[model samples]
Target: MISLHWLILSPLIIGTTAKLMPIKAAKKIMVLFQTALLAAVTMIFVEVRQNGPLLENIGSWPDTIGITLRADLLATAMVFLSCFLFLAMVIFVHNKNYADHLFFFLFLGLESLIIGIFLSNDVFNIFVLIEAATLIITILIMYKQASVSVYDGMMYFLINVVAMSFFLMGLGMLYKKIGVLDFYALEAALSQVNNPASLILPYAFMITAISLKAALMPLFSWLPKAHGTPSAPSVVSAILSGLYVKTGIYVFLRLQTTFAPLIDTSELFVILGFITAVVGFMLALAQTDIKLLLAYSTVSQIGVIMIGISLNNPAAYWGGLYHLMNHAIFKSTLFLTAGMIISEYKTRKISEIHGVYSHMPAVGVATILSILGIIGAPLFNGSISKFLIATGASGSWIESGLILINLGTIIVFMKYGQLLFGHSDKKEAANSDILEKAVVLTLSMLCFLGGIFGSDLIAILFNISLTINPLSYGEKMLLFVGSILLGLLIYRSLFKKRNPLAFIRSFELGFNEICLSITLFFAFMVVYLKITL
Candidate 1:
């Protein structure tokens, strides 16, 4: 008999087999399987809500011997969010034709790895799951068969697989020392030791490896390439950016909590988070391609989430998790809108794709709402979480720094909004597929309504009633207005004359490679300097 835990792998197994069938059948089968997966996720989420954490040991083996599959509040929340997006993507793709069946294989493989990442108890298993995800997602990016996507996918695969190898090695060392592969066991072992060398080296290795996979700054060069170039389904990109990236951070969070004694101070993570937040926005501000801009924005927002997690306070943790969900919905919807616009207008360049509103009102309105949500505008889902993040960082320099990041976010969105509204000479669009429109509109509505009731949702999810009232509403509204004003000023002063395409042309190939190499060199040098000095 199949257990409830194995339900998570149902779509993966079915989709993988279906991909071997005829292309037409493969897509239909995959869609059905995805719906089933969604149902499974919903049931599991209901279970988690009613009963704290749900656990099942595969094969009915003892806890120490068999693999344990556990769904905690965070894990269930991520799964629920990811599965929701995946179903939306399935609907969006119903009308879009693909030549081959390999896409379903890649999708299923990623889904399996996602579930595995959240369910597995062993540290080594997590590494394996991540490696599987990396390999499969790379294939998905290359499924486009375009030279750009293929080359970018290869680079992303190489980088992430290498990072996972490092993670595995670190886990091996920890297992060797502790005689167990369990996170709880290894953490307990680390706490009993006093040697900084033994603890810090492994801890640093684990965090660094996971951070690279999460596309946190300095190691995030591959993100814009892969995400921007792939014929990424909005649902796929949503989960990849939303839930998969968070898996790395989840590991780091677990390590921080369980192995706090062995971990380095939060100082390093906080500093890196700050760097990631600032640098990502700066780079994002310099992009002309809509997808690439959103990709960089994702990198920047993940940085903000990291900073919140690094604070190690309950407020920060809750805020980080909240923002993670908010970002998944809004950014994915934004990307979906971008895809729809590109499909209709036959261009990825934001400058070339003007007057979209003239032909694609639903997509345009959805895009605008998604942008508003992400910008943390008043009554949007994003504002609530952003406020929490800022509130958590209050009275610290981090707060001030986050203010700058928020301002940058607003500035970028302001530019995006201008692009949405500017230079209209009515041009007819090629395809206005009803299914695609429906999916996009659904996601966009979620972004709007999610913000309107963010507080009630938070209470339901975390079992804590946050003190939110009219006063809090007014305060957040002021922050939003201030950000908008600053963004307008920045755009008027700095971006008024520059040709954005020129910047993109310069960075196409060499910039990312150089940045990645330099970061790897610096990581090595940090070690060398530590030894020599």
Candidate 2:
């Protein structure tokens, strides 16, 4: 119980303490502190795995009156992943010269906020932590003080605050109707309610805000800007794509489960997920900036994950969860590698950064592995998760949608793959940072191992027994090869022509438009729930 508290608070405590120290000493202390926190989180994960969930209520107050922190399997798994990623990121940046005390302070604070969001069972606590995390991320985005970054940071901050206000309104509604802010209590009360439709407005309000956070469709306009800001650090971009956005998915999962008795919106989510995937990859194809391409790719992958979860099949749910983990690993590797590439070439344009294999073989190799993982090639982690999702679809249109999404992914990455080849006349020195190389190698290796032992890995993480179909393997391979060929053909014949997607690439929605979109989404959700429930 106390272990959970320490995991959440220790970072905040240490970060504040380190602020008073000299820069060099503070950097060392911060790294050491992160290492210790990682070990502590690992131990807590083991305890939770062995002893079931560990729940603690602040003070001696009754369950309804006290704050609850629960270390269940899902929460522990997220915390463990967060800690591992943060540690890797810290190590990756350790030797860089931009080690500012305030930067580390905000970084650690973001870690604490994420852990708190995962552990807290109280609705209000999660809300507050999420808001704080948003502020920290905004500051981190604008840390370099680049002119355009200020606008990007302000857009991210203001838009998210508006979205969260809806969450607060929904929270108030829940308290008014149920007289409790606890997840378990709300679920119990909802189950007992005679007319669940009465909660439709609250549900709409909350889910609307969550959809924005998840960057689904129209709400996703802000994601590429924030994640691809030229001034933000690569680690910041990695954290945003790899972990922060998933907080919305986490909350979405929790809220949907809590309201399961009241409504079943899985089909609607399935349609929306498909839309998001298509829109995301299409936009990704239009990007010249490498980071923006990755940012839009995150949007597309989030849609894929959403599709898997909304399908509501056991295998698909497990696949979605596995994909969530895989995305974090491979996407982080890709972003970090992209950062190195940008640094070496002094450019973000994908077309300009050729001969990576000759210039930086390690990063180049890692980038290829990540691309394979994202493209769902056979014997990659993405393939296994995608296989599970497709199998669960049982040859329906949903499976077809998955294939189309994969095709789009392959097409965009096929363009990106250009950087891996071609010759450069100028010679460049190889990166000598062992820590950075090790991080990329480790994550890339995990991508391969995860695919090789996909079933066993699933059983270990989720305790679900899934068998691979040998017959399906041949068909999947055939489809994958066909998609690759088609993607290459499409890229060469269509994408290389006059840039027709310039409008989408340059489009920006004003704050008023974003608010209008949110309102429309909420109203749509309310009407849909009213009719369905």
Candidate 3:
């Protein structure tokens, strides 16, 4: 197996070296490096799956003092996913307008940072990695250097800096109290404490920042602006939507596990998840700009993932993790295709774009598969995960809520799906490069294959096998159909009219409002723990 240190360092090394080469040669070098990196990541993933976690403390120091790099199942899986997606993003940008040495350099640098975050055992190290990632992402968003792009990039940067301050404060509290920054060391230290109450404020502080990073509820205002920046390239949007946002949720899971003995905030996140999901889709429904619509949809999907994770059920939790992977595939496909569609049609408006199938059949097909995957259509990746989540929520009011969320997802996509049909006389040639098309279609195909082998994938990823009950699967299939019909009816009656959801489109949280919400959220978490514990 490859060393975890190299897994985190190789990308940065290649990126720096590529900068010194000729632009033409750099592109070729990038291809070789990406191929080698992905192969190394795959081997590490296979080794971890076959054996167990690979743990090392760097600098040859004692475990408690050294920087520990842990390649557990979760960390390795995330590394593999990040590597795969980064490779795809690189390929998607090949021969495209934004395929420059500097872009690839920043892109690979971000990959290294993300890998570091995944493998880090020290909470402080995670904080540092996230800070570096935020800066790189800011530069990426502002890559166009246009007036609006700069403003969006700065807005994203300012908001994240505020959030990271909360994280740093929490880390300081934990270290001061436990005298340990490493997760294993801290967990051991925390167990000796008599009162779990001491960690409440720290949990509140840290989770508040992580929730913001996950784009949860009131903190989600930055997502649309960053992801839908008019000047941002499709590859950038794909990585932001498909990969970067997930790091927040991944960190969220890590912190929750670390504090498992002290706190059980699943209920709070479940409530927040539902609200975020509902509100997110409502905003998506109101949007006319196609990229903004997809960005808002991402907010809604994150909410669904949170619900799956926090439901306090094994089925739901695994489903959430599985859905997280599925989202990376299908959503990346959508953003990549959306970029192509916008380029070909010369507009981002949902109403203005038409004849997608006639204009570009391959892209149109990919979009259809991706939409199917996202909406949880039967025999797709989303259905399997949502089914597992529904199985966990069965016979409860929460089940109805899950159904409603599914319906909302369908309705929003129904609005977005208008791009696939209508008339066009233009010929289909010059439809993006073949390589870009291949990347999008490959992700689209994964959306299909992932479902067909959902249970097997879970077994491989989680080291646990689950068999989907045939009878229950049939029932879920019915619910899926029913939700589709209901979503379509609602879309026509309410959405197609003078557009009932149109006004909510303009609703956006300002910087001040987002900051206030963060404080309130933290207060709520602390107070809730104070009373309950």
Which candidate comes out best when scored by TM-score? 3
Model 2 lDDT per residue over 119-184, tens place:
999889999999999999999999989988888999999999999999999999989999998988
Question: Where does candidate 3 clash, by residue pair?
Answer: none
Task: Using lDDT, give the best candidate's number.
Answer: 3
What is candidate 2's local distance difference test score? 0.88
Query: Which 10 residues in a row give candidate 2 its minimum summed lDDT?
Result: 424-433
Q: What's model 2's lDDT at 409? A: 99
All candidates in order of TM-score, best leading: 3, 2, 1
lDDT tens per residue, model 1, 292-316: 8888889999888888878866676
Q: Rank the candidates by lDDT, best first.
A: 3, 2, 1
lDDT of each: 0.74, 0.88, 0.89
Better by lDDT, candidate 3 or 2: 3
TM-score of 2: 0.97
Please identify model 3 stretches exceeding 4 Å from their true place: 425-430
